[model samples]
Every structure is written in structure tokens, then in C-alpha cells.
Target: MTARTRIAAVAVALSLGVGVSACSTTTADDGPLVVVTTNILGDVVERVVGDQARVVTLMPPGADPHSFEISPKEAALILDADVVVSNGLGLEEGLERHVDAARADGVPVVAAGELVEPLEYTAGDAAGTLDPHFWTDPQRMVDVVDGLEREFAVAIDGIDADELAQTSAAYRSELLELDAEMTSAFAAVPAERRALVTNHHVFGYLADRFDFRVIGAVIPSGTTLAAPSASDLDDLTTAIEEAGVATIFADSSQPDRLVQVLADEADIDVDVVALFTESLSAPGEGAETYLEMMRSNQRLISTGLSP
Candidate 1:
């Protein structure tokens, strides 16, 4: 072959090789990649998986899981992960399509939210809708940890089962401790003052866990994406006045305008407090991790409901 032809062929081969390498680098690496949809589940799965795999959380800190959508890059990560973990039952409203696409593409997905003994709205316009915000109750999150460990170990090629089990157990212990502390903290609130009003119906599990009454939600639905109707607001305002609720809690990740409307409509003395309900906050904000989120919420709820 001519020398010029040989040089051209070598350059072509080098270009093709670089393309292949870039594809491999973008797709994945040595460790298993577990893509989690929400920061709350991301933190819990991070605890269970430990260093066994690389956990990539799609939702950012302080972002709403119910409405947060992943970018194309993050969607690619989901498709490439060894296993995709999502909080199912409609919590991830914006990301569901991408998650479904990943599942169709053959990625094993563990919807940890399904592992919980699910709660449904008892009495609201959205009654009977499954409550997807199960992390409000730490015991339910313990169930999530159990499911994640099982699925991650099965899907990840070389994940250490022993390490996963130990980490899950340790995390469950911590959740139990949190449950106990929350129960005790809530017990301080008088029964009459245990009424809960919130920006949305995001805390059914918490109310069920701690024996508090879910008087009404400002949005009248399980999701913040749903706005309350005029009648809905009117009825809730009446209920708030009748229940003599002292506090209305709003999500820290959401704008408080709708909640402010409710407080104004009620025209009563109600403290509007913010809680890290649907998402964890940035580090040092007291709701960085799942455990930290629960503790901070517990204190807030206790103080809000105190007579």
C-alpha cells in the first residue's frame, strides 16, 4: 500500500477508536450505577448500597419529586444504570415517562415506594388516591430500604449481599429510633391540638404514624400540581375554623402563596410553618438526609401542634 493511504487508514481507525471509548465512558463504568428518582430515596438507597455501587440521584436537593423532570443526560443515566429505583405510585409525576422508557429498555427498576404498606387519602376530594409520600413515616421507609437491598443485590452483577444486608439492618435500626422519637415528640401535643393542615395532602403516613388528625389540605389533593377549587378552599377554611387548628404547614420546597391564601381565607390565628416534606434540603439546612429530614420535621410538627 502507498504510504499516504496507510497514514489515512490509521487516522480513520484512531477516530473510530476514540468514538467507541467515549460511548463506553458515557454509558457506565466499573461499579454498578443505581439511579434513584428522588433525593429522599436517593439518600436511603445511598445508605443501603454504601460503597457497593455508584448511586446517582436524578432529583436535586430541595427539588420537588412530584414535579421534577430529569434532563436528557439524567435520562441517559437512568437507562444505563444497573438498576433504576423510583418512588412509585405517582409521586414522580414529571419523571414517570422517562422511568417507563428505561423499564421498556430492559433496566430493572425497584419502586421502593410500593414496598410500604401504602396509605390512601381517607376523606378529601382526592379520596382513595394512594399516598406516594411514604417517607413521611420512617417505618415505611424501613420497608423501602428492605426492598432496595433485595433489588440492588439481585440486579447489580457484583454487589456484596452481605454488606448490603448489614447496611440495611443498620439503617432500619436508625429508622426505628426515629419512629420512637417522633412518637414521643408528638405525644406532647394535646389531642385537641393534633389537627394538621398542610399545603397539600403529603403527610398521611405521618398523621397515621403519630395519631395526628389530617384536618384538611390546602390544595385538597395528594399532589402539589393540583390546585384547589373555590369550593375546595371554602370547605377547607370552614373545616379549619371548626377544628380550631392552630397551624398550617407548607412544604419548604414549594412557594407558600397558596398556603397563604388558605390562612387568609380562614381569617383565624394560624401559624404557617414550613417543613421539608416532599424533598430533602441542601446540606446544613437540617433536612439534608432522610433521617435528618424526619428529625427536623418531627420537631417542627411537635412545636406546631403543641397546645
Candidate 2:
């Protein structure tokens, strides 16, 4: 199948809320296939690869990467893919077996987390473990793009080197511009109020990059699958009170009930704001791409924290 036909099929499947495998049926005449685990990585891979390959992103838009499961057909796509891209560092809990199977079958797998300098959770159950949400920092994402370009040139057969170089360079420039924008936007906020409390521990990289303090998280764990105890909530409330945080940011892909409960039950006054932290939103929902997601979060964080 041609690139146009494959893109049309994927668009139709997404419109109908179907699995990625529905549009990723391969043929002898088709280009190379790239099976990506998360939509965030998928967006970057698509931007890097352009139309030279068929990219099948397993995780749907606005879905939690920690617990989203895939169909058998999607698993088959991984095994049959020329290259498989994942966030790695244990982010995709539901697709580990499939990714391992593809690796065992001799397919090249490029992990974004491994490409960037990973950060560890500072105060949660995953404190000593590697954090997989490196996309939170656009500089780290540029590193991943550099790695992807190198990996794709080797892994994807018949890929045009000149086209890949051009696309990757263009996307890298955009990421650098995004990093500068975020830095500028965040610089306006007072340093004393640059504390962040989220629904989970998803912003360690962002905090490290932008000189913000991660006060605490509602869940107190790195993954959304973990729950926060009453003690966790109490401690976070105390920390919030001490820091005098005016806004608590929650993941747009996950429910903000825990955040809301903390805001309502706590004696301190705090506003619960949503940010596109982990997953991208659906079309026209403000965070359709990685760049859009970062810019939206930058604006929200600046406005939400400014006194």
C-alpha cells in the first residue's frame, strides 16, 4: 500500500476509535513499519520519519501510558515491524511482553528514555529508579530525536538518508525553539513560588531543567497505577501549606479527583490546574502534538503560578 492509503486508513481507524492494527495491515509493496508504544513518542517518530515509513502508535490519544493495554493484532505489528520505539524504563507496563517478544525475534528497538539522560524520582516509591517521562524536557527530547535519527538510518531498510537528515534537523530546531520559549515563559514566575505539586511524580525532568521545586504529588508514586495513602495526602498538604502553593497541576490524561479532594479537604487555598504532562490530547483539545503540549503547559504554569 502507498503512504497516502495507509495514512487515510489510520485516520479512519482513529476517527472510529479502533486499534492501531486496524490501519497497519502490511503488504509486500508497503514501506518500512515503525511500531511505537506511546502516542508522545509516536508523534516524534512520525515527525522524524515523515512519509518514508508506516508508523503505528499503540497507545491512543489521551490514554494513560502506565496501564493502557494493547490488542493481539497490535502485538503482531510489533513482531513484524522493521523497528519498534518505546519510552522504556518501565513506562509501558502493559506492553512489556510484546516488546520483549519483538526483541527476541531480532527486531531493532529504540527506547527514548535510554537515549536521554534519565532522572530518578526523588521522594516516591520509584525514587532510585529511572524516570521514563523525559519528554517533559524538550532538550532531552532533542537528544531522543538525535538517537532516533541514528537508529532509523540503521534499522529501517531503504530509508533515504538525506530526507531523514532534513526532517530530523527541522524537528530538532523546533525542539530547541520550544526549550527557549519554555525557559522565557517560566522566567517570569517568581522563584519563591516555583513549586509544583501534581497528581503523580511525572515532572522530575521538567523540574530539574527549569529550576522548579517538585513539592509533592497526590499519588506520591511515579506511575498513575499507584495510589496515595491518607498519610501521603496529609504530608503533601503540609508541604503545600509550607510552600504556600497557589496552584496544583494535574495530568490532563488522568482524573483530577485526588487533586480536587486535596484542594477541597485541605485547609489551605489552592487551585487545581491541568497540564499535558504525560499524554497528548485529542485534536483541537490544545495538546495535539509534543510542541503544542509543551507550549500549552508553559503558558498554564506561568499563568497559574504568577502572583
Give the TM-score (vs. native) of candidate 1: 0.89
Once fitted onto the true fold, the runs of candidate 1 whose alpha carbons sit more than 4 angstroms away are 1-30
Q: TM-score per candidate, in order?
A: 0.89, 0.90
Model 2 residue 104 CA deviation (Å) reads 0.6
Among all candidates shown, the one with the greatest lDDT: 2
Candidate number of the best TM-score: 2
The lDDT for every candidate, in the order shown, is 0.78, 0.83
The residue-by-residue lDDT of candidate 2 on 164-259, one tens digit each, is: 999999999999999999998899999999999998898899999999999998777888777666566678878988999999998877766557
Give candidate 2's total backbone clashes.
Answer: 0
Clashes in model 2: which pairs? none
lDDT of 1: 0.78
Candidate 1 per-residue C-alpha lDDT over 74-132 given as tens digits, one digit per residue, 9 for 90 to 100: 77888888888888888888888988998999999898867888988886667988888
